[model samples]
Target: AWCCGAGGGVKSAFPDLALWTAGQRVDEALSTGATVLSSACPFCKRNLSDGAGNRNVRVTDIVELVAQAMSGRRMGLT
Candidate 1:
């Protein structure tokens, strides 16, 4: 697992850097052939989703996945 780069006010103080960091992490995830990246933090989700822009990967929260599962809905990016 990697830091989503939105922690410690990085997203607010250094948005570009945070995005770059998240992109790097996303690249690592893609290297693993992952189609989805899940996080428990809303900040992480937001940053990861932004970093995954135009990429064939989905960034979502664990709660969302759980909700989808409970609701019998197909899991997907909203």
Candidate 2:
């Protein structure tokens, strides 16, 4: 989640709220013309990806992108 409003014990304690919060972030990301959502935190990635659902968005970790970049592979929605 780019804006950082999801994850931590919130998702563990209140899952519905976590996904709902993640949805808000995904909406903002969509507005910015972002095709891929990236986060280093597993919780954020999981929650945000769940929020993305059928939308044309992909959730990834920054490390993955860096690795792709190092390998000279373009990283983005395919």
Score every model by TM-score. 0.86, 0.86
In candidate 1, what are the lDDT values of residues 1-78, reduced to their tens digit? 779899999999999999999999999999998888889999999999999989989988899788988999987545
Would you give me the overall lDDT of model 2? 0.81
Model 1 alpha-carbon drift over 4 Å, by segment: 71-78
TM-score of 2: 0.86
lDDT (10s digit) by residue, model 2, range 41-73 = 877888888888788888999798788889999
Q: How far in Å is the alpha carbon of 15 misplaced in model 1? A: 1.0
- After superposition, the stretches of candidate 2 with alpha carbons farther than 4 Å from their true spots are 1-5
Scored against the true structure, residue 28 in model 1 reaches a CA lDDT of: 95
